[model samples]
Target: MNSGAKDRPSTSFSGVIRQNFATKISLCLLMALTIVVGANYGWRRGLLVVVGGLLGVALYYSSFGFTSAWRLLVFERRGAGVQAQLVMLAIAVTLFFPLLAVGEVFGQSLQGFVNPVSVTVALGAFLFGIGMQLAGGCASGTLFSVGGGDSRTLLTLFSFITGATVVTFHLPWWKTLPNLGAISLVDQFGWIVALALSLCVFTALFVLVGKFSTRETRSLVDDGPVDWLRSPWPLLWGAVALALLNATVLVLSGRPWGITGAFSKWGGHALHAVGIDLSSYPYWAEYDFGRSLLGDVPTTTSLGIILGAVASAGLLGKFNPTLRISKRGAITAIVGGLMMGYGGRLAFGCNIGALFGGIASGSLHGWLWLVCGFVGSIFGVFLRKQLGDGPYRNTQPQVEAAKP
Candidate 1:
């Protein structure tokens, strides 16, 4: 109604309605807002903002390297296994040192947000990885896939939430890691010295791997040698992207990104608030890590994930009605979900927070989880085969089936 509105064409305002990377970027910005509103890791460590950004970039790329790491590990190809992961990690951790030094530049020593190695944390993370391999999705993968229209993933997601809730019900009886007063990596060793050695060692390893490496055929991961940017690539790119997103999550959110805890926290809180006091909460509090195992992170994010998936699927003309495996599959999902939830609660994170987050953070425990998880993967694969494609009941395979 105003004269200023009359002067300009509505095209500009209508342009915003168009879909493209602009919308994607804008959505990412919205996600960042979630950090401002929900994250607990305030700017205490944000004292050295510049170095922190650099450190964040390093973290992002390390996780990016991790995208191809698992496939390379499961199937050998040019020693891409740990070399890529380590190279990126070394670069990430080395650069992180300067941030530590510069962080103290303001004479305000910031606390480093890192968890130390513990058998319990490692084992729990391994369990989570096994869950992913068996279920055919990681936490972020499940979120995005379910968002993108994979019913199996949605089924898996339901179990994931249920499992987390189950664990929360018994959290007091599950904790095991000693929350060693928050330790920063630089404090344990001289920042400069740590950076120099890690860089030298890892770079050398990269060279060694590349030299003796046997280039294998392409795996499911686009890492083999194919352009996945133009059209929608396989799950590989999605995996790497999630890893990168996680690093930013740490930079912006302080603590590592995780899904199980949030789920468990919500479930627990919901139960507690609904005049349905489950005796489980108090009983489970005795565990070393039993607290908040069931209910924590915002349900809005999850709701967005699921709804986003359905919408994306529908927009892509991929949505349909179907169920996963059979009754046995459903039971397995529920039980596995229970294990994953409780196990993640036992640890401080699941795949996102511990495995991916730990590896990016350069924690020794992360590798432990990876190894243990692979061990668990052996079992998961066996179960999948035994189940003989139990559920994954595809309604429109040609239209919307995701690879396992």
Candidate 2:
């Protein structure tokens, strides 16, 4: 190990201090931003915004789908790999929009609101999901993955932009079906009922998936065969804890949970720096499910995700060094970025926008995105195999193995 690492060693006081500083500052900033967002949108809406984000993250994690993507791609988990994903899909199907009806405290702002739904919106959301999975990361996942120095995400991120653009520009041509729909599950149902129903469904699926799931080589962070987190004592509390935190964010944040808007913004700004015009892209025709309601440029949520990712990575000792894009990958990143930007516009959202934000708000569009995205993921998995996972990989064992 490097002398600096040896001296601080993460467990050491100095290391802990360093690790916490980033998050502390981030949390403070995030909360402040949340307050501002809440004030602008109303405290109830702001709170719901944060809670929605928290719920999305926790539910997604507890369901154990997104984490598997890490193992399959980063850690090389394959074959039965789809097992975790399948469970997540079930969870996504079950709780995503249903929770909207009951409400999540602060979500009162969204209590009566509903996203207009249509077949076109559904198709767009679905396509976006698949595109994100293939791209190897959704908007939120891409932020986290890229923060950890994964170069492959750059490819998918770019592809997402390209796909979005392609879809957006052609939106007028495909305006064949109802796209936006009304809120079915909004806040009228009450939080208790929503939480209870959500928990009930999540529990049933968890048991089924856990019962049926195999445990050959499991990591503690994700559920798998022989998983410790899955054990009775830890499982219930773990779920509750994560769920509570998610609910809290909703009470504070105002909007729904999301991670792609700002990320896509990075790609957008990059185009501008090089004299490329983002305005050339259609603003109305694109997939941005939620317009810039938060604020002008560098919205708090997107910024939070990027910084949160950075903070998370640094604390975990995963931050190494890399420009993260080069050669064919560089070309891919730019193209993919455009696609995602355009796609986000066309589809009305990216992974978080459509999947988490839309679903949480009781939008049918979110659910549609999930279905189509799953189909797209299969194709994405194939692409990852062929093109190679961007430019990053686990170096610990793989590095030693590479030794001749």
Question: TM-score for every candidate vs. truth?
Answer: 0.62, 0.60
Highest lDDT among the candidates is held by which one?
1
Model 2 lDDT per residue over 198-259, tens place? 44654664466455544434323344453322221122333443334433344444344444
In order, candidate lDDTs are 0.49, 0.47
Per-residue error (Å), model 2, residue 315 = 2.1
Q: Candidate 1: where is the Cα deviation over 4 Å?
A: 1-72, 75-113, 169-185, 196-230, 233-244, 278-325, 390-404
Error of 1 at 271 (Å): 1.7
Residue-level lDDT tens digits of model 1 in 1-404: 11222222224433333323333643454445335433443443222222222222222222233322443444344354445455445544544456545554344442233565665665676676556555655565566555444456667777777777776544454444454433434556667765666577668866876676566433224444534322224333444444444444344434445566667656655566676656545743443343432122233334444444433333333333345456656655555565566566556666556665555454556556666765665555446546654212234332212222
The candidate scoring highest on TM-score is 1
Q: What shift in Å separates residue 89 of candidate 2 from its native position after superposition?
A: 10
